[model samples]
Target: MSLGSHSVMQGDNTLRAWRTGIDTYQEFVVYMRRDCPACRSEGFTTQARVLLSAAGQRSIVATLSVVEAEWLSSGDAGLSESAWAALGAQPGEPITVSHAPPLYSLSHVRAKVYGHKLGDTEFAEVISDVAAGRYSDLHLATFVTACAGDRLDLAETVSLTKAMIAAGDRIDWGRQPVVDKHCVGGLPGNRTTLLVVPIVAACGLTIPKTSSRAITSPAGTADTMEVLAPVDLDIASMRRAVERTGACIVWGGSVRLSPADDVLIRVERPLDLDSEGQLVASVLSKKAAAGSTHVLIDLPVGRTAKVRSEAAATSLGRRLQEVGAAIGLHVSLRLTDGEQPVGRGIGPALEARDVLAVLQGAANAPDDLRQRALCLAGDILEMGGVVPAGSGLTLANQVLADGRAWARFQDICAAQGGMREIPVAPHRQAVDAHASGRIVSVDNRVLARAAKLAGAPTAPAAGIDVHARLGEYVEKGQALFTLHSQAPGELAYAMSYVASRPPIFQISPTGESQ
Candidate 1:
């Protein structure tokens, strides 16, 4: 039987065949045709289809899934499973086979260190297949690999973003310059979004920040905000929340924003590959769909962060700027230091505590947290033209200190659901400074890991709240940090992990410090 240009001629007629094991199936499986001599030659394979068991029970097959000829007209590799069954085969069977059956379309090129760019049509088809769920994990891998290693151009980035937006729910706020800000994440304790949203909203701008739950980290913006208020608002309810308060912090995962990107993210997370093209599309499409006209993107660049080198950071920054403009979004990128996390809290509840402190004007609100929030808010302010040029920082600070930001935050949370105090972990574990000096560097990744081991987003209260910061002097016996946990065992486990590790805190020998 010819599948296409070449005949599916039998390669071998001998008894010799490669044996393969069948999984979870009680009876053996193999392919056969009712009309073939080979089918007649093997009595069991000849029947139209029949069940054979050790008990000698037999059942006749009336019909199969019946995939028609259109599916199998081309290469058998692309053949539908129903077509395979129609030709008579069980998937796990050890069947007699021939040479490669007229399939000449595939190329087996060895992949290089970095991937090459895919054509626009090819890329769109790949995304189409991904969106339609026609591609399996392996096919998705090929799609991702083909476009990996910064392989997309500015137009491609814009196209991909538009495709992603088209694939998901789009929010039309019917307002010009609807503003949003996104952090290309990596710095742990960078819970600035919680502070940024309220401040931007306080300055009479519409800011709807839809955040993600943690994938590999201890906490995400959604996770930290979850510590303060409910974040799982649906599309209609969420829009109402934003309308009532002029701002909303909702969970993006729940509302299906850029849904295909969510699927890609799941695979990307495990592979540890953040493809620049995919990253750009994922960010901007969500912003575009959310109806953002102005976007301030915070790209933290350092050795340990997402965009490590300045060269990579600069390239990414330019790409973001260009792509945003192409998509009709006014864009600005600020590269902050990823050498250290921006806040003293390293988990959801702990970070929520830090944010609340900043909002409520607590005496112990972290200066780094406050400063970054104000700076990012200032950028949004200037970019959205909420404040005059050169005075973004001053305007932001005034709104924050004079109780306007806090008041707005209260209103927004109440509009969503009432504001609640960040919950405290009933169990507390304190770690004293091992060697006191001027605090230097803190490894946020390790610290975040330790917090996860304790209990995080789930435990709400379970996390690390740093009592010390860079350049801060501490006594050897003074408490360096506090670990909060809802359970005693979790507190113990978290404490044990912290104890086994060397000083997460880097301190200088020189006593004189700020």
Candidate 2:
């Protein structure tokens, strides 16, 4: 069989490459655009060809997502994957890709990315693709990874932030200086939004704080908050609550704050890959579009948490602060302890109970959660430039102790539909330690996976509720952790998973006991 160049008809661009192999693994070629130099940088890039009847051209274009190969780690692979998906071409189906305009080429930035701002039309095309569900998760991953690491210069971050904002619905509060806060979350139970919003509103700030349901963890702020109140409110309902009470903590997933973000997150969550640049963009884009004037970023640094060291935290902190300034907002990043989960509770319903207890001033309210919330609220007050530095913490504590935050919380909850208690799953089993000693470490990722095994987030009530934390001493027979599930089978599955992956936690001093 002869392998050689074949000129194929396409609209504006020519696709040419050596026909190298065929049969079994599929016929293959090394393709390149003589006019576009991007292919040269990453060997040969792949582009799937799709044939469309003249009238069918509109259908194909409408169904396709924008593909920019130059910035991807495997731009060639990404382009091949997305284009193949777009063509809806089967294994044996022939495809001819028409030469159409490239949505927004990264070729210009390939020189060194000195400065590049997307024009409106180009911006619209990418958003259209995202909204249309045209791109696969991996393709989205490529977009995120290419932008990973390093802070985009002020001008670039600002432009990208604005473009992301324009990509989705804009909430006009008909007011100035909307208040919001976000944690660069890794701590398991740092459910501060459950407390901060009420305090800020009580202090006369319009905080329509939208949170998320658990993506990977046992719970999210929305999940915990949902235990005491409704979190999945419609956009109109959410806006009305904020308009009426000056604060609302509803889930953004329901209202679509930045829809493109939700799609990207679905891809990133499983891959466990949140590239640095994408993270900054994802966090700030939502805040900017929410019309927030001042935002607080919680950076929890710990040995096992998201940012493992103080140095890492500070580097991220500087980027967030500087970028916020460029985008015309005041951003304050706070460093918090993330050595372990924030509160005594580890799952959704349990965390909700903790939130309510704090609000109602229960004598045994989770102190750790309370302190975290106060620190965040205080910084928020300082950012508003209303509570002077050094005075904000004192004021935040006062709001908590005086019962004003509690009352405001109740009012906001009632406004966000109505308050109720969600029941924890009744089926449960406990895991006791095999030996006695101080709890040396708790592997968060493993623990999170175990919770998933037990049926968390989906099961809602079913999750591991840790009775012991790091440094706590326990008897050999004492309960190390408890697994709750909707069914006995699921509970057993969790137990089996735990047994197979031993030492989710380590006990000190070495000795087998009762």
Highest-lDDT candidate: 1
Tens digits of lDDT, candidate 2, 1-514: 2122233334332222222122211111123343333333323233332222222443242222223433322112112333334434443232333433353433323322343444444444554555445443444555554444552444555555555667787777877668789988777767789899998889888888888878878888888787788888987898889888898888887876777777677767766774554576678877876768889999988777889999999878877777677767788888998777777666787677777788778998878889889989998887777688888888889998899999999899899888886677888888899787888777676777777777777777777777777778888889877888888898899899998886777888642221
Per-model TM against the reference: 0.75, 0.75
Which residue pairs collide in model 1, if any? Answer: none
lDDT (tens digit, per residue) of candidate 1 on 317-415: 888888788778888888888877777788888898889899889998888889998999998899888778788999999999999999998888887
How many Å off is the CA of 374 in candidate 1?
A: 1.2
Q: Report the CA-based lDDT of candidate 1 relative to the real structure.
A: 0.70
Worst 10 residues of 1 by lDDT: 101-110
> Per-model C-alpha lDDT, please?
0.70, 0.67
Worst 10 residues of 2 by lDDT: 20-29
